[model samples]
Target: MKLEPHYLKYLAETQDKDYILLDLMANYGNDVWNFAYFLTRSSDAADDLSQDVFLSVYDRIYSFRGECTMKSWILTITRNKSLNYLKKQLIRKILPVKTVPHGGTVQSAESQLFDRMETKRIWSAVIQLPRKFREVVILDAHYGLTDKEIAELLNISQGTVKSRLHRARTKITVILETDNEGE
Candidate 1:
């Protein structure tokens, strides 16, 4: 796979730690926060996790080896941080909190309402999935990561990523179908 142009720039500018950190945050801050929010389903946790991920990146920037795209590497850190945050919450036996989805201004009211409802329904099904399935689904569908990138990010085989994505989609289909039947 080809490396991101910014990744090459990032590699070349590692000496200017502030510039690298700022550039990384400017480029990937949204991706990191969104991934964290999707994983934890909490804006507050996402915020905290985003901060932690960036700080970790800031501290460990030198350790980057270019084995993957810089975005993939950053997202890998995000995934790891999110999982750890969830684990700690689990260990504490604290219930996870839900976050409100953001709204858009451009669409007509009815169109926006229907769009929100559909998006909520689909995400509800996705949220109910097992973590492994959820991870692959969010990585593949939300982030549009290639199977190879996801496999590398999650440290799974490419076939496993494909399998999990298939199963996730199938489970989501079943869930939506059941919901429709009820309606």
Candidate 2:
């Protein structure tokens, strides 16, 4: 699934960098988008953040030391960008900003509404986790990365990834259970 190192170097050095970038987008766009969405929890923000990740990759990929897979490198960019986006959002909330009016989301089927509500509740629970736990949970549950891979990506031990995942799941269960009891 991973391309060779020489090919990654070519992408960094080639004159046809735009073409190479487009090809990279075709391969990794979904992963970038999903990672952004998982972190930001906003489709619009995720779209912008995903584009920013590609832009950052295009500009700085030559600096990639090949310490990890290209996917991890780009995803690290995404994670950083999403965190930056969240910080900006927090600042905006702290300081009132002139906001533009946007249309609301369209309604779907009743079943879809129920599913969306459930998903929203779960995500809210997930978002409440400590940053370490949330990151491991998202990388594992959303991206299907192995604990070993996550440990490498996170620069932590595999045991840490496993334990954090367990804690995150347990926390989410308690949160949802408490919510259900309240309802």
Candidate 3:
């Protein structure tokens, strides 16, 4: 999900805590949960982490100075929560999961099945990346966050983000090539 351009302004102008939070949740809930799932690879953990993220947002609303977009703020919270959950659980394993790209046009059954398999294969390679690399790739490719945004969210320099993204793409290419050779 993409960030609405006026969301930060809307959030700032709103005075009622409940209304602001509900609006945030309505706008960003799926994005938050999906990011959590990408990090943890567990639906259950994503559910818990998303809840905690919203709770933190509610508690820390006053702290938001609008330095960043509202989506960035919410996603930063989600990333921190997911990482903390991973650390606490000692879970570094990433299970492969299919995330089919969204498309509208209908396709033949054979074409659809092939697309699903290809998407799954690509996602499988992605999840196999190290946490640092995987997070950058997902943030860039899936969430469409720019290098500066990702650096801010991940607490790394823009150069580091670029390096990681480059390395991650190289690794993914090698992996897919290997898979094709094996097949």
| Best candidate (score: TM-score) | 3
**lDDT per model vs. reference:** 0.85, 0.76, 0.88
Q: List candidate 2 stretches off by more than 4 Å.
A: 1-14, 88-120
lDDT of 3 by residue, 7-119 (tens): 55666677777888898899899999988998999989999999999999999987877777788899999999898898899887777695657787999999988889988
Of 2 and 3, which scores higher on lDDT? 3
Assess the local accuracy of residue 74 in candidate 2 as a C-alpha lDDT between 0 and 100: 81
For model 2, residues 1-183, the per-residue Cα lDDT tens digits are: 445566476866787768767877888898899777766667788799989999988897667777677777788788888888988885221111112222456656795667666766776787677677888988987677778778887788999999999989999999999999999
Cα TM-score per model: 0.86, 0.71, 0.90
Against the true structure, candidate 2 has what lDDT?
Answer: 0.76
Sequence-dependent TM-score of model 1: 0.86
The TM-score of candidate 2 is 0.71
Q: Rank by lDDT, highest first.
A: 3, 1, 2
Q: What does candidate 1's lDDT look like per residue over 1-183, in tens digits?
A: 646666567668657878888989998999899888878878788899999999999998878777788889999999999999988886322233333356556888898777778887888888888889988998887778899999999999999999999999999999999999999
**173: Cα error in model 2, Å:** 0.8
Misplaced by over 4 Å in model 3 are 1-5, 8-13
